[model samples]
Target: MATPTRPGNYREQAKTYDLTRGASPTIVRAVAEHLGEPRGRTLLDIAGGTGNYAQVFATRGFRVTVVDAQLAMLEHSARKLGGGHAVAGAAAHLPFSDGSFDCATLVHAVHLLQDPSPALREAHRVLREGPLVAVDPTRENAPLFVHEYFGLHPPDDARPSAEDIALLLRRAGFATVEHHPFVYTDTADGSLHALHTNALHLAGPAYLRNTSFWYGLDEEARRAGLDALARDLRSGRLEERVRAHYLEAAVRGHETVFAAWP
Candidate 1:
């Protein structure tokens, strides 16, 4: 997914970013657990749109600062944080002094960076001997139904794998790097119908519009894919197809959290 270079690119999407792209509690728990006790330590959440993850960390007693390039996103983040720190800044050029934060998190936002190396180095610069935890969906995973339905296959050149992120951290002067692969399985009752319904819900318009995958597709492809999906949904074939897809791959996908010690 390409990162939007300007604030205007996210103006429209920022309004409903939280409604459609809320933080996954499971992922939030994993991030918190990895970071360990906050003990009133400060955390810098880079590219933290809407502060979804940052607010959760704040509740756990971490002094969280959410930084994003888009003012619109930071506006939502500011509201969610309730007078907490939310700054408009770029990842590579964070407006903070060295060793400012105790720990840092970059959840599902690394791919949005046009160039990740400088940002990773900057993260290393601002952190004071703490782990930088980054969470992202790796390329080495089962294809998501949303991607397949929308004809949104991420180009290998653009998508960074878990290994790539670890390598970047190491290059940025992190001493140790560990990868924890997380798979979010369906928790619904073990029924084909339920599974199909769950998959269908994920492919809905609200959810689709929020994903980077949907924006990656061309106008022609978007129209064609939507038409095909609509046809399937109307004809009752969507359930059957969704069931078959899940039967082939029971797990949702592989999202890895890379913890790098500075």
Candidate 2:
């Protein structure tokens, strides 16, 4: 199988993506409820993988436009969200006019962007007067137990800290950019924790199957990594603790809106 190099091609791995990395629907509902009514506003789900967020908006009676750079991702989103409208476009170059949407969001795909500012600007440009939300797991609050088990290190990408995200919103013409910490937690002995650990164990191999770019591991290092994670899981090292912090920004402009991009 050919390796998928772009985010759009993620559709080829969409099923696995959902199985391994899908967010809890309960959490989604909880978070969305905090943002208040979707009513009849139009929402632009930027870099919306598989249309998870877009569908959430739709279910709340909001008109949704799902945008992603990857065609495969858009296809998957369309399929999941009832063949709804989607745009094959980059976050930095949205094909909409100024003040086109009431809300904008980017979920978990910012680190992959070569330039996040332009995407931020595009999001601001497309919104009439609404909040731009970014929902991502913060480095400060990411699950630490899995880091050791998976050989995961700190992020190498340039990310705006939660504070920096609010500053960016202000710079992008949002009037009252505010942040709320959206946290996720599961205790050591909880079923949620077990499921997460098992999923993490499979995620790397699943990603490798789609693309074996694990630094040319020569099969030895690859096996070793998996073995290490497995050992940690069985010995209880993998269940130390789990928590994720999401940053939500309310951008000020034409109309009030709330969004979480992480």
Candidate 3:
């Protein structure tokens, strides 16, 4: 089974991170709504790379402070949102006092941690009776093309489901927990042509360098996967396989938000 590259491995990808990953307005609204009206309250964005979500949250009236382990990523966040707001710290060891934040958010960051319990506990400790919203990818809803082409499969032991995360939240001292599952279908073109284009893009050198799946693969495996994808595309077999995968409902991707309160 394939696992995501460690958080420390993200340093080189920080320069082009914003190009492929940006804050979605829809996700921002969902997280903000769960966090409640900002009311000028302080928000701590844990593992917030480049301050993408932090920037949006600040505009929504939350005094945002972004904490990331990577100095390279923190540098970008500092540049985007001015200096003091970006702090160099680990999620499990946040440099803040107890009950320092009105709310907290972990956006697409749980997978990076080897163990998320400590981080959840830290979040609960720093929050003052407010929500700690976490957005995590649902492995069950991962697109099949990801596994078929990249050979990346997140084992259940490594990637927790929504229910598993809720249990962790409870163990971390959260009293109430709510799950909100959402599918990212707005960009799904639902056609063979769209699948073809997406496959080519995923197999491209730029994606190989930046994406976690490609980063996790060894050099020989990466080369083999790329070569196989190229041959399939040339032989027109890629479209056929993708169409069948879509029919089996393997092309859809979704995520879940776990809102926990202390």
**Model 1 / residue 125 / CA error / Å:** 0.7
Give each model's clash number.
Answer: 0, 15, 0
lDDT score, residue 57, model 1? 92
Span of ten consecutive residues with least summed lDDT in model 1: 187-196
Top candidate on lDDT is 3
Q: What count of clashes does model 3 give?
A: 0
Pick the TM-score winner.
1
- lDDT (CA) per prediction: 0.73, 0.57, 0.74
- After superposing candidate 1, which stretches have Cα over 4 Å from the reference? 1-8, 152-158, 185-197, 234-253
Whole-model alpha-carbon lDDT for candidate 3: 0.74
lDDT by residue (1-262, candidate 2, tens digit) is 9854543336465545555445445345434654557878888889887677677678878788899887866787888676547888988899888888887777666655655678888888898756666665343332323334335464634334666666666676667765554333321111122234234443345544332124334466667777776665566654443211111111111011235332
lDDT by residue (tens digit), candidate 1, 26-75: 57766877799999999999988778889889999999999988889899
lDDT of 3 by residue, 184-224 (tens): 43222111112333555544565555555556677777777
The CA lDDT at 42 in model 1 is 94
Candidate 2 global CA lDDT score:
0.57
Local error of candidate 2 at residue 54 (angstroms): 1.3
lDDT of 1 at 88: 90
Winner on TM-score (1 vs 3): 1
